[model samples]
Target: MSNVFDGYERQYCELSANLTKKCTAATALNGEQKKQKVSEVKAGLDEAEALIRKMDLEARSLQPNIRAVLLAKLREYKSDLNNLKNEVKKIVSGNINPSARDELLESGMADALTASADQKTRLMTSTDRLNKTSDRVKDSRRTMLETEELGVSILHDLHSQRQSLLHAHNTLHGVDDNIGKSKKILTNISRRMNRNKWIISSIVLALVVAIALILYFKLSK
Candidate 1:
């Protein structure tokens, strides 16, 4: 289960990094190239979104504490992906236009200058957003590592407790065997004592009969 999450996280980070680099490079390209890059970034975001949904489903089958952390992280990633998708769409639709200085220069000098400035500001904003997303990815990675470590510790403790209980159970079984042997020995001794008492009573009865016969003979003489 931990391995599953590890795989998902690795794939997510790799794809996200690739997409961010593409977005940065797109800023310097012409309209057609920028559109192509935006399309590619959108595809990557879609893949990442699928991975998050998979993680969310897996988390639901886990323990409550673990589920909560995983779900929270999933939500954060989903929100970031949504924002990224919107930003990429804006770029594609000319809302967050990149500089086309040479083409705009034919129109008028003032219009070209203003458009260039707006494009630069929008690019800067996009860069800032990318940096923030990178920071969040780092934080999420750290949290996942902590959660994995905690789960390992819990499993180790449970295994130790099971071993202790098994040892105690074996010890009690040995004690019960010793007690059964002692009871058998005591029963044999009791039977021997009863046999000795019966033999002594028979000998005393014979001696008393012999003494009575001797007295009767002496009186007859």
Candidate 2:
């Protein structure tokens, strides 16, 4: 199992190296390099595809699981080849389209391939943007939920505080009423004591007058 994976890895590395070399050649070429590098790239792609097919065939003979995996990989390689071919066609059509300059001039298979490649690129870009927007929306929604929770918590706390304040106010009002009643009672007691003192003073004055009158009458007798 591991050996097959290792083989696939080696093949993948080789294919990557070959593509890189071809691309480098394409870059280095002035005019003739384009044709040569293009041909080389195509040939490399074809060889890689053939290798993938052969590997898939061998893997299929071994086991069902291996077959499935290898077949999937083989399909991927083929898809890559098709994509590269389309890209190459796009490049070719770009050159032809400018010179032909006729809208009715139906482009060849290469042109159609180029259009397909362009459409695929646009689709991929659109998909990426949509995914990004979706992720952002999810994040925003999560933040909003957190904010809503915070708001609910704050409201709960405020409600508790309000209840406590109301309870405290009611308790204070009861205490104030009790204090006012006590003050009124004290005032009434003070008023009663003042009235009793005044009454006692009047009685003493009356007794002194009575004593004086009795003395006068005895003297007279």
Best by lDDT: 1
TM-scores for candidates 1 onward, in order:
0.43, 0.48
Q: Any runs in candidate 2 off by more than 4 Å, and if so which?
A: 1-108, 211-221
User: What's the alpha carbon RMSD for model 1?
Assistant: 11.9
Model 2's TM-score against the true structure: 0.48
RMSD of model 2, in Å? 15.6
| Model 1 lDDT tens row, 1-221 | 24465457556655655665565555556678878887788788889888887777788888888888778767766775675576565556664432552332332344334435544664565566567877888999999999999989999999999999889889989888998998899888888888878887878888788888998899889
RMSD of each: 11.9, 15.6
Record all residue pairs in model 2 with backbone atoms less than 3 Å apart, i.e. clashing.
none
Model 2, 88-180: lDDT tens per residue?
A: 564444453444423313333434455455546645655565678779889999999999999999999999999999999999999999999
Runs in model 1 deviating more than 4 A are 97-221
Who wins the TM-score comparison?
A: 2
Which lDDT values do the candidates have, in the order given? Answer: 0.68, 0.65
